[model samples]
Target: MLKHKCLDQCIACTACTVQCPVTAAAREFAGPKMVGPALERFRLFDQDIEISADYCTNCKNCDITCPSSVPVSLFSTLAKAQYRRQNGKSLRDWILVNGEMFARLASPVASFANITMNNAVVRTMLRAVGIADRPLPKYAEKNFYRQFAELKQQRFPDKVVFFPGCYIGYNDPRVGMDLVAILQASRYEVIVPDVVCCGTPAVANGYLELAEEKARRNLRELRRWAREGWPIVTCCTSCGLTLRQEYCELFRANGADEVASQHYDAGEFLLEMLEQGRLNSEFIPLAGKYLYHAPCHLRAQGIGLPSLELLQSIPGCEVNVADAGCCGIAGSYGFKKDKYDIAMKIGERLFTKIKDSQADMVVTECGTCRIQIEYATGVKAVHPVSLFKQALRFDWVG
Candidate 1:
């Protein structure tokens, strides 16, 4: 984020650079502290930024590791967006950033959409557009919105607005359904209103205006719910970070303060409810050990590993935290043909850890991270909520 005031506070500390996963992976990255804060003074005079802005994946590792709270990733995104504005965005960039719109279009004909999307012609066209040859996830048969409508919740006074970001809305409705079931078990009525992508993909793709526009589209509903004191919980770590962190940094959107203070990751919310003596402790013990990867966005929120803690509490579930670093797919960063190799290289450490752990499955909060893990290591990966759903013996609604 490299705000001017934040840059001014930089003590020339190499802490951020030292902790950056990209810098560790690629020597050309020029590190976070140098490219962000150090370059700001030169950038003010219109000195062409010698460093490649695209080198940054906007993973926020620098932001999280900074001692002075400088938003290193913010500066990267801002610079990239500015660069794109001056130049031009390609069709591939447009498609990746506007994933919300594409998912909606693919929903009704999801089966056919996947086929056409993967056809040889489509792959060639996608490559020409600068998108990767990587296989895209098929849209969920029924989006969570439709599934939420079918949910027959026992009315409760306490309610929460579940923010099912793009992944849950169009790709993994089961996560959302599992989330709703857990909340219902905890006696909280889940109210899922009309919402759009939180725009994490847009930010990563350097489409600031589109990202903010999508944020506005969803904030109208989020703001009203916030005003009424409803907790806005998101399962997707990227979406949670966008709602609680990015909105204020970029647009300073209304209700953001309330939302930031009140929003929770689904795992964190469940743990919080459990701590206050409200969770349904009637979990049927799950068998086998689990390897958990704490998503970078989840860690960015400054909340302790609530999901990991919760998973360990389940009887017969031996949990091992993947101690490895970022799992490369920072939003859609890994899906670009150019960056795909860098993404995989960055994830090598995590993949090795997952493989060595010898767990039956890998669990993480980000949907894209799950995709990356499965691709890199041939092991099944799932959200922590999926394990919770099984442990709680709640039937999958999707």
Candidate 2:
């Protein structure tokens, strides 16, 4: 049996609580130290102490800030799984977490779905059911999977597997198309593997078993390519983080370590190529002041701002890190009615910073961060890879 990792290592240093955006924004959240490492001790004895793990948001700020290297967010995630086992999940959670299922179902009638989601009556009904009144992402008429099927790519000896998470695959396929163009331009053949949701939304919503099962399934396919030394890359920060770190830390799924070792964020992968002098430097110079927001999960990976590094290398592209903290939409966390206000409150710092910057564009790897930034600051947000595609002057036909 697997034991909870590093709970004993916590010396009760309140660093995690200090860095917790949720705790700062909302008092109801019992703070990471309290609900995580502290209550975790009680949970070890089957004490079943009341925990506010639901408010965690699983942003991994605790893990990032923990001086002792304790997996604080893992404890909260485990608590959520345990809570789900005892009390079951709500309808709102079911709808929010099963994004892939809903996306597939909604893909056929995407236009209608988008219209229905924006209808005032629909918003009222969604609010009653605990979904936030904030605008939902519109479903793409052709999902990334369908678009990838029709895509014809120039063959290259080097190949990389692309894991476009549910958001890019279903909601905004243009990002995936941008990634494909960038990869192809870099002389890498892109392979869209038949992978599941990377289990982030499910894990965030407390579906531990479901998340683990999906992890194992993905590991099987990912490991096959990994063993052959093919790199697994993702445009989504959360999905990339899940593939590279969470699987090993949380599920300990077989081959998770091997797969983790080879996984890379698309920007990180491109940055590597640029550093190795393998990147295509023939770029159309686009002059603009850009602000980059590093996703919380990406920061947790301990990779030092690869997207910012890459974006800065482009001629005439002035890029600056937002450094304003978390955007507060922890996957589907902000979509919940009760948590929406807290999410917005947590995001205000970033919003204020973006508004102050007067940036021509905001660049970020996380899709939800783009949504939250645009929604809060009324600033346009584009993915770093998408920006790179634009720099390369690639015409994207969606």
Candidate 3:
């Protein structure tokens, strides 16, 4: 019940509402200004919360757009959590929020899980429970931790701890491998820590207490490495944002400030190495035009398009910033039946732009953003770190 001081900074500028993609796409939404700061005033007085707060995708566009640095999305997210506490949450939300549990249970029988997940009967059953009709991200046969256990890596004096998060650890282990290769080539030993999900899924789904539990668990390990001077890195922008911003902002997690100070997006970390004249420059020319989509979470970090900047460093690489705005996935937000259409509607502008660009590939830092891009536009989407790894090793097969 700790009230945020950010709520006091709202000046009724309406800039947040103007930049709110959800408000623009879905007319039913009361806009971030009204649902967030405005309703927060009543909530502080123990008044009933408005239902419109649930429409917020928690994409953080409002946070990025606020001139006064008001955390509009935080307010909306908390309201959603409080409302759920009173009314109770659905089974669909319970399943969606516990990503780490699902990943661990499914990874052992990945092929069967993947096949069963897409079957008509399973899809129908899932849809009946309010899961979306869209395709789900397939589970990897071997999760990132298992793959990394068998990985042969050269030891370096300079080491960095990597938080793979659930997406890379469960669905796409290859991205993690690519990141390891990239870091190794730059003479840094990669350390994959034993950490839980960054708890974004829980926070977004109104499980605030669960998110705090996760934050504390992760901070125990992350804060240790952070204090030891090993830079903590994550390839997923959402994970980065949650660890560096949300843990402190929403949960007031202890040692979050220290961990946030050391946390960096993989590309952001590499970009810093480049700026400091320490990044490996042995990358061969990679000739391809890639359209890059900046995830709303990455933008919310207030770091200027680090992945886009990193990708541009490759010789002969033509990287264009799509700048079309949010992909609208917002982690598990798009996977709910009720929010799926709204998510797609919010992404229409970006989808249209990608289809017209006809780039060799679409690159981004968020796993869900890549999924949405490919599903909506029929374009292959990959993480920026994967492309950088290819460029570094001259491994482009095309």
For residue 20, give model 1's deviation from the true position in Å. 1.4
For candidate 3, the lDDT comes to 0.88
- Model 1 stretches astray by more than 4 angstroms: 393-398
Model 3: per-residue Cα lDDT over 1-398, one tens digit each: 34557777889999999999999988889999998888888888879556888888888999888998887888888888888989998999998998789889999999999999999999999999999999999999888999898888888999999999999999998998888877776788999888999999988877998989999999998898999988999999889999889998886777899999998888899899878977665778989889999998888898888888888888999999898988888889899999999999999999999999979899999999999999999999999988987777533121
Candidate 1 lDDT tens digits, 22-52: 8888777888887788887777677755647
- lDDT per residue as tens, model 2, 1-398: 23355766788879999999999999888999889877877888878757588888999999999998988888889889988988878889988888899899899899999998899998998899999989999999989999898988888999999999999999989999887877777788998888988999888878988889999999998998999899999999999999999899888888999999999998899899989977655778878999999999899888889988888888888998899999998889999999999999999999999999999989999999999999998899999988887787544333
Q: Per-model C-alpha lDDT, please? A: 0.85, 0.88, 0.88
TM-score of each: 0.96, 0.96, 0.96
TM-score of 2: 0.96
Q: What's the CA RMSD of model 3 in angstroms?
A: 2.1
